[model samples]
Target: MHLERLVFILEVVGQKGRATVADICAQSDLPKPTAYRLVQDLVSSGLLESPARGSFAIGKRLRRITLSDYSDPALLEVIAPVLANAASAYGAAFFLSRLRGHWVEILHVATPETGVSYLHPGIGKRPLHACSCAKAIAAVSPELLSRDELKGQLRQYTEHTITNREDLAAELEAIRAKGYAECVEELERGISSVATTLTKTGAGSTVSIGATASVRVFTPATRNKIGKALSEMSQELSCALGWNDADAERICA
Candidate 1:
């Protein structure tokens, strides 16, 4: 009975973006009485929206649930403190981003108390090649973009940004080998970042720590330290996402 109702609901929405009880009953192959009762129940439970008259569509509650589940809060909680600590220690801003469709969206950011930085990405989308967080993830996950697509158009966000496809490809290869990426005022002058990819059970994500500093700040020694911390935080996040230690190590390492 529940399965039948679920199928009918999906079918109703599939046929029409919104539906009335009578319309759903006819399209879903259910009796009018059953369709009406189920639709009322779904609407009451906040799964369906009834804005005017008898029209119904998927509701905001369901939409929020879908987004929240996909961008799991439990996983974010595990990494938040790590980012905060990194930001505090380095006196910089740290960000965690995830690839959302064709864009990278910043999910979290931590700003340092000491440094006065101008750029704040906030919760917004950034171009794949323009930000260190996006590039770090893309470097390890070339499957994220098609070869032809990547080669076709690479925008230069700044003079130092990698606009050439061939050069960017080579840089990505190095990032993959070394398990980290760095942007030395490449996206904007006076801003630098070091980033690493985060993966869980074969699912890939990225986190970057950025500061208002010169290229000199990203010395080999500093990068090594940051890389170690980033690797640890990635592992913790992967575990929160249901990845076993072996899987987490393989993905983050």
Candidate 2:
């Protein structure tokens, strides 16, 4: 009975976007006190967000749960061909990633036959400010990083890394205007990358795709090519994910 009531409360909140104690009680047909207690339990456990004194919505823990499940085989099966094509066209490694909490989580990587000369960050969480995929995800959603958050995490991994919060802001603006982000040996010496946000999940989280190679391989012309490729790939992926074609074009444009 307790589990059923809890699930009923979560369902009501999820369907309504947000709910107050009265809203949950009315929707779930529970007594006001019981509804309030269940909602408070969810908020305390991090499964729901208390946005105000009484209002609640889905929380980061639930978002994290959805993101972690992005490794579902069907989604990967659909994305594999696209990554292969992008990797082949640009002669660089391609990857898919998402912004989760304060870190960028690497979801997938598709490398060229020759492999990349630069060291990969591997498949795991990476610092948001230091990688092109993260920057691209951030470019589309700047509110994810408060000024204080940026300042606190501006650890320099290489001489080219953006250590200044102001400079990073300017760079992100440029990336937004141009539809892609770049990391020039920022995370590792001799490595550079171009990236674009691929799509937003149904839960409203940003996911990105990118290509990277050694600085030597990513020449001025190569960067431009990769930038365009990343943008096009983002659009295609967004469409496959059921994003409106016109909206996707405007975002990637």
- Predicted structure with the largest TM-score when compared to the true one: 2
TM-score of 2: 0.67
- Which regions in candidate 2 have their CA more than 4 angstroms from the true location? 1-74, 114-121, 147-151, 199-205, 249-253
CA shift of 6, model 2, Å: 12
lDDT of 2 by residue, 1-253 (tens): 7998887677556545677889766544578988888888999999899888778987789878755333225346667789877676555788877654466767688876655444354787667788988988777777777846455788989988988867888988998888888888999998888888865334223677788788888887888888897777777766666553455756646
Per-model TM-score, in order, reads: 0.63, 0.67
Model 1 clashing-pair count? 0
Per-residue CA lDDT of model 1 for 103-128, tens digit only, reads: 66676787776665434556766667
lDDT of 2 at 119: 38
Q: Which ten residues in a row have the lowest lDDT in candidate 2?
A: 66-75
Clashing pairs in 1: none
RMSD in Å for model 1: 10.1
Candidate 1 Cα misplacement greater than 4 A, ranges: 1-68, 113-121, 147-152, 206-216, 244-253
In candidate 2, which residue pairs clash? none
